[model samples]
Target: MLRKALLTGCTGFVGHPLLARLSNCDFSVVACSRVAMPALPASATNVLVSGIDGLTDWQVALAGVEVVIHSAARVHVMNDQSSDPLAEFRKVNVEGTLNLARQAAEAGVRRFIFISSIKVNGEGTPLGSPYRADAQPQPADPYGVSKMEAEQGLRALAAETGMEVVIIRPTLVYGPGVKANFLSMMRWLHKGVPLPFGAIHNQRSLVALDNLVDLIVTCIDHPAAANQTFLVSDGEDLSTTELLRRMATALGKPARLLPVPSWLLEAGASILGKKALSQRLCGSLQVDISKTRELLGWTPPLSVDAALRKTAAHFLEHRTH
Candidate 1:
């Protein structure tokens, strides 16, 4: 009697690894994607659909699927010169996600696991003050606001339809095939490029791909996770300088960091119209996963150092020479 699961975003950064791991679990997996995907796991079923939106239908795909893991969303856009960023984000993240969940509930799906962002807790935290799951949500950006709205919608739907909902808000996730700032940092570390984060001291929590996937799988059948919102991260927190040093060590290169003042760096970035990047490099954004740990008795299986080493190794191996 294998439980059936439908997974959205089967081709995304988190979705790809999740699909592979779920294929080995006791449950039968149905991998759904909007774009073209590579060969899927033999034991898993693959389905293609249009973009996630209010009009997107999942009738055939949701048939007999007991669990739904909604991982697809409009993630961060670097140069979002859009007229109305919130409208764009809401169109997919809120309307699209709710549409899927609503259809899943109608199709008799038992549980819906949503992969949300810690940005829903607000951008950054003060030193030593970690974000708690119950904290008042103060989503700053349009993306965060959209995710928060989606969470609210899901909770409302759950109350009305009796469908279990599990919400996980994770910090920055990194691993193989990781792109954007994380990947750029790895490349710079591998090349031994001097960075100006030596003077920045801020604790930031992050989640490894393995840890995130492990928790998602655990939530699939964990009775306690039903209708619960959890903020998850690797227990250990690190500063930008420390992260660069660790990455350099993993790449067998020296940490060539310059002792530039945080204020000066911020000013330079502001002048260059990259204030967001500077803030991420110099700000504190820690997540307190005590609720997730105590409630589910779950802990991240991998350490930050181990995760960074694995990411660096993957980049080194796959980087175009």
Candidate 2:
């Protein structure tokens, strides 16, 4: 019998690819989306939920689900107008996630895979030092704090219910249909817009969407992955300048980078009230995925160059339409 798997946020960036990957696996997918996703594979049973809050009904989706992949959450929003960001984030990320976990456990779900963020480890790491799976969590923002709290709650619940829990903390994930910072960079490179990241020598680790989805599928049935926390990446780190150059090359455009000082960029961002954005563009945030490899005996199948090229090709092909 094919195991039933419940997936949250199947309409989102990561969720979309994950659902596609699961289609080829030995599991039947129950894709839960907040809105209609008509393009999903016919094999997937689409469940449109009203919300992901504590009061949301998930009985229909959780029926006979052997695995639960929780990917939906209150993500970061620029210019957020919430009166209390932390409380608002907690309501969904922490409360809603635990509610789903509890319901899944009651429904006899065998494994619960929680897709978390690298920010749960901390904002950024120091030079030449990468974050480990066992690092003490130091969530800086409200989103990170909520994820940290959710992880703690899930662990406690696992201890009580004996439901296998596997947590994966991934860095910036980029691929086709990727949005936000990665998309913006791709667009800039495609348009030949000059950027000032040539002086940034900080190393940052990133993961491809395909790579992350592969690991999640592994955890779904791997006995060694139970009750484990993993820091996953592409096993390759790159500097900002190198990343942009490669992206531009993939787009068949010249990398227009100005060799401006990182300090100057920080000062300008401070004046513009974008200190955090500047830090992200210029800071190091590498993760050590040795534990994930050692435990799961898995490696990322896609190389960084291959992922970037794929992303660039997709962007170029779609932009002309």
Question: TM-score of the candidate numbered 1?
Answer: 0.98
lDDT of 2 by residue, 1-321 (tens): 777899998888898889988987867899998788778775788899988888887888999898999999999988899899999999899999999999999999999999999989999989889999998999999999999999999999999999999999999999988888888888888788899988899899999988999999999989999999999999999989899998888888999999998899989999999999888888899999999999999999999989988888789878853
Error of 1 at 210 (Å): 0.7
Q: Which ten residues in a row have the lowest lDDT in candidate 1?
A: 34-43
Candidate 2 total steric clashes: 0
**Top candidate by lDDT:** 1
lDDT, candidate 1, equals: 0.92
Instruction: Give the alpha carbon lDDT tens digit for every residue of 257-279 in model 1.
Output: 99999889999999999999888
TM-score of each: 0.98, 0.98
